[model samples]
Target: MNLRLMAALGAALMAGPALAAGGAEILKSQCVSCHAVEKPANTSFERLWERKGPDLYYAGSKFNKAWLEKWLQNPERIRPAGELYSRHVKGSDKEDVVDESTMTPHVKLSKADAEAVAAELMKLAAPEGMVEKGAFKGEKVSMSMGAMFFNKLRGCAACHSAKAGTGGASGPELYTAGERLQSDYIYSYIKNPQKIDPHVWMPTLNLAEPDLQRLTGYILQLSASEGK
Candidate 1:
């Protein structure tokens, strides 16, 4: 994978909701500064970072439990361009002073605490009751529509990739999008981009609920989910 593209994907992943159960209070104290428990709109990334954290409203919908646990225990060396605690760079640093009035301290996670938090965190649910079970016909229609949506409406290819026929400077490459995202995750993102980044270039256009569904369906199907 390309370095810049990976960076874009890494940054994009940061936009999702995080699951940390026993860590819930930790979330309440340390994480909620950016994430909105109620809905995704309140949590555009840029907006949340302002208070010193990224919005984790969609954690239930986005992260892998094990990865999140490890991340909490030892945050990755890689830092998102505008991360709230970038000044410290990694989990060991103490220089990143969080304003108590705005953000909370980065308390270390205990094994039991991390597991409990991960279990609860994974339950983050979205209202997709209307979406029928079983995969929709994708391959062609989905890929094409996803491309169109990314370029014209959502403009995801921007910042993420140029092949979508539009261009952005900051995001990642979707060249193999089919190989990356899960359908459930993609659909939820289209419904609300703010959950990922309350203020990233990705905007929350007032797309009709159904249209949002289709967009997500298409994106989830953007890459093949098998034989990675």
Candidate 2:
């Protein structure tokens, strides 16, 4: 190899770790205030309720690397009512309403920082067996069939919306789940949310294996149809 080419290769090899370190430093300084990069030892309801943002300890298992990179650069609200539903809700005579002002937007990172951060985040994997292997087989579900399972059968629409400006505000929006979440994580979490987050508000539906597969496919299909 030419000396110049060899030198370039050497630089590229060194840059990877340096970029990861930079991302870690950025998270430490900026994101630590709101997000928990490390899993909390305490799983109390108070600890869970006081959380400012979603736990990112298993971000690698939860989020798509491409989506994370782009989202970090231009942050948007994934949860319409905010991370802690109780905090953002106000009771009315008829029903409770989410106070939009209570929802805080995520901080945006520069393009370079976003890339570095995303690279680092993708290293934070879940504990072994947290995600079931080959759980989702890239199965395709029609939007109508998916909706039937989500809305009527499973009652998922009570908390999650298949589309924007629809469904309950307590849970994170499902409209972008296809791109935002890993398919295995979705299936596993839906199979048993308590296994993932001990204090998570989501209930265990005790869904059948086929139902799990269908729900997973539906979420992916929903996001695609919405152009997310």
Candidate 3:
């Protein structure tokens, strides 16, 4: 073989390991500085305040894979102010320093890398079935009724909105929750938020089954409409 061809093969061989490293390895090297792959033992506000990013222990259950893949490439700020901890703190002695604090944009991942990372993340699921009987899948709340519940009855609009760039910025945008999240996951998380994420700012509504079904149905419809 020609020397030129041999050099090219040698370079390709050298680059193989990095390109072949799996998503978990990529996450360990690139993402662990800011994110956690395991559930935190301490769920206190103070403990959460020390975290640089949201935990990824249950990313598989919490986010849609397509959304996660797209988000990794075209990153957007989910929490406008920052994580719950950064947004609530009042003084300069705050411990958590998030991307929002530095005004740094999220690192954009290549499409292939994003897909791999999302696939790895989706492997992490809740140990048990957290949703109760998967109630919201068949609930029949009308759009108007759902709107009433979201906007007035349940007061969900106080922190969450039906569309992007329209609702309160503190919480995540729910305009696409139906497409972005699993229905049962929503039911489970809202039913007992602490069970999934301890010390989260979201309160345990302890809603009755009917209300839970109605609210979940409303969110499903709202997300389906894309806030139209």
Using Cα atoms with residue i matched to residue i, what is each candidate's TM-score against the true structure?
A: 0.45, 0.88, 0.83
> After superposition, which runs of candidate 1 have C-alpha atoms over 4 Å from their true positions?
1-21, 38-49, 77-79, 83-110, 127-158, 161-169, 172-182, 190-200, 203-228
Model 2 Cα lDDT, one tens digit per residue, 68-171: 99999999887777877888899888879988778777788999999989998999998788788678988788778889989999999999877898898889
lDDT of 1 by residue, 15-56 (tens): 444432236666577556555554554444445445554444
Clashing residue pairs in all predictions, respectively, total 25, 0, 0
Each prediction's whole-model lDDT (CA): 0.51, 0.88, 0.75
lDDT of 2 at 158: 96
Ranking by TM-score: 2, 3, 1
- Provide the lowest-lDDT 10-residue window in model 1: 76-85
lDDT of 2: 0.88
TM-score of 3: 0.83
